[model samples]
Target: MIKKSELNRMADVANDRGVTVWVEFEGRRYGVTPPAATPPLDDTEESDLDRELEAFKAKNGYR
Candidate 1:
């Protein structure tokens, strides 16, 4: 299992490699800048899209 600190570290590494990490908590959204990158989407947007996709898959009976 990955600890939160480890995950955060990985996020940092990813940022160094041109990736960014977005995290969500308590219905609020926040973003962290990597050493040299930006997150693809804000947490709320990502969460919304994820929810929509899951709903679509469920509607289509996609197991």
Candidate 2:
């Protein structure tokens, strides 16, 4: 069971790197783009994820 604080920390690191972070919890997968969401512990960010997420947020703003 992962703690919410730990998740928040991981999100912060991913945000700093301008990457997305995906997390699979409770048998569900969640893909979070930096500034809004971060990728899981996949060991690497998806190609163009930063660009893609940022553009999406710019267009729609973070919900």
Candidate 3:
């Protein structure tokens, strides 16, 4: 069994590596789950063009 300190250390490493982590503990019961990811901002004109360019590439198999 991993100690709580060890689990916290692992979580720290994961966070440093840009990985998400969600930890839960209830005495003898525990759960380890990665949190949901959030995408970057999408409210700019560049993002709109990016979406359109992606669709164009998909349609032309450029990617």
* Candidate 3 residue spans exceeding 4 A from truth: 19-36, 44-63
Estimate, for each residue in 5-59, the C-alpha lDDT of model 3 and write its tens digit.
Answer: 9778767766676664545556564444445579776678788999999999999
- Name the TM-score of candidate 2: 0.42
lDDT of 2: 0.75
lDDT of 3 at 33: 42
Cα lDDT computed for each candidate against the true fold: 0.72, 0.75, 0.70
Output candidate 1 Cα RMSD.
16.3
Candidate 2 structure quality by residue, lDDT tens digits, 1-63: 778887887788787988877778899876656764554755345656877888899999775
Inter-residue clash pairs, candidate 3? none
TM-scores of the models, in the order given: 0.37, 0.42, 0.37
Q: Could you tell me how far off, in angstroms, the CA of residue 6 lies in candidate 3 after the best superposition?
A: 0.1
Strongest candidate by TM-score: 2
Model 1: residue 57 alpha-carbon error in angstroms: 0.5
Clash totals for all candidate models: 0, 9, 0
